[model samples]
Target: MATLHHSSFCPHSRFVRLIMAEMGMEPHLVEERPWERREEFLMMNPAGTTPVLVEEGGLAVPGASIIAEYLDETRGLGLSGLRLLPESPAARVEVRRLLDWFLQKFDQEVTGYLVTEKIHKRFMTSQHGGGPPDMNAIRAARSNVRYHLKYIGYLISRRNWLAGSQLTYADLAAAAHLSCVDYLGDVPWDEDEMARNWYARVKSRPSFRSLLTDRVAGMAPADHYADLDF
Candidate 1:
């Protein structure tokens, strides 16, 4: 069985989880804090990031995008339908573009804010290298949330999924980052019905169930957090 060492609040980890779910592959899970700097964990991933995958034969795989591609290639599930990556140049470009948007743009603008404010202190209360989170930064992120939501609304309004017609890794990436924000009650679901509807579908998936169960000390998630219908 493949083992995953990850934190529930991480969007990148969640992205890989969504991919395994889309492929109908489930792996055993283990929770670990990245900051502990454990010898084994650090050896497995010198970058010291979560979402490291231990393959069946025991090779530590780092990074969500890399792990997803590994799963796709090893499992023989080419990205055509739900997997999203395809042999065709057009399909590959389409999926790649969306993946970049979510992993880079969404993570930098949206997840960075909420994770630092709500989730980071839990794992990083001791590792205050960056000093306390800038409330101003969080405030800025909160303000930027509206723009992200509107952008998503536009995408969902035009395309069925964030990338291409089918539910691709891009949707999972967006949903993963959004989930972290949602956990902090920062997401304004009421901003767009279309966006809300899209999230509902992504939230209802079984892979997302684990993420919904996450809780940070003294930081209780909002009431609508686990509610699929809400």
Candidate 2:
């Protein structure tokens, strides 16, 4: 079995975890704190990011995107009808585009700010920027998330999933980030019923069970965070 270096609240980590679960690969999960910049972790990934995959041969694959591609190449593509990536070039581009939108753009604008301010800071020490949560950043993230939710609603209104007719890496990526924000009780699910419904479908999947049960030590999830019908 492979080992996964991850963090419960890190959207990128959560994204990779979801991918593995979907691919029917259960890895040994080791939660990590990227902010600590541990020497060993740095050796594995110079950037000290989470969601690094260490295979049986000691090969460490770093970053969510790289890990996703690596997993698909090594195993996921063999899943046939269950593959998270599409086979056609145009369809694959759509999946990749939405994947980037959620993991990069939505992250920078929403999930990153919310997690850094609410979750990451709590676990950090004073010297490592640990302190009271930044209300300003938190508030900004809350406001920005509504736009992304609206975008999700717009997309889902037209298609069965984020990228197209089938579930793809894009759906998992978006859900990973939304799940983190939802844990903080920040996602305004009521504002976009279509988005909420889309999320409900993803959240109800067997691959999402582990994530729904995730706990962050001192922090509790929102009331509806684990609700399948919500």
Candidate 3:
């Protein structure tokens, strides 16, 4: 069996988890804090990032995009479940585009700021630069999320999923980031009905069940974190 090293509130880590579940790959889960920079974990991924997948054979795969592509290559796309990367080249390009959009753009503007301020800060010591959450950063992240939610609504209104008609990594990527923010009750779900409806569909998936139940050591999820109807 493979082992997945991940953080509870890391959106990228969560994205990889969702993909693994969707593909029916049951890897042993090891919750990690990348900030700690453990030597053993660093040996596996020199970059010291979470969501590293170490195969039973001792091959380690780092980063969400690499792992997702590696799984698609080794497991054979569309074999066990939905094809995360679309078959057609054009379609695949679109999927990758949206995947980057959420993982990079949205993350920098919203998820990254919020998580670092709200969750990571609590876990860090003053020696490591950890302290009280920055109210300004949190406020900016909150304002940024509303625009993202609206953008999601616009995308889903035209297509069944973010990238296209078929569910793909794009959806998983977006959902993963949104799930992290939603856990903190930062998402304005009520502001965009289309986006909320789209999320409701994604939230009900079997792959999403584990995330709903995920609880950080000292932080509680939002009241509706696990509610399918919400």
Cα lDDT, all candidates: 0.81, 0.93, 0.91
Tens digit of lDDT per residue, candidate 3, span 1-230? 99999998899999999999988889899989888889999999999988899999999999999998998898745564578887889998999988899989999999999999998888998877699999999999999999999999999999999999988889999999999999999999899999999999999999999899888778888998999999
- Which is better, 1 or 3, measured by lDDT? 3
Clashes of each: 1, 0, 0
Our model 1 lands, by Cα RMSD against the true structure, at 2.1
- State model 2's lDDT: 0.93
Candidate that beats the other on lDDT, 2 or 3, i.e. the better one: 2
Worst 10 residues of 2 by lDDT: 68-77
Check candidate 2 and list the clashing pairs: none
In candidate 2, which residue ranges exceed 4 Å CA deviation? none
Model 2 residue 118 CA deviation in Å: 0.5
User: Using TM-score as the measure, what is the rank order of every candidate, best first?
Assistant: 2, 3, 1
Candidate achieving the largest lDDT: 2
Model 1: pairs clashing at backbone N, Cα or C within 3 Å? 79-85
Model 1 misplaced regions, further than 4 Å: 76-81, 127-132
Compared with the true structure, the alpha-carbon lDDT of candidate 3 equals 0.91
For model 1 the TM-score comes to 0.91
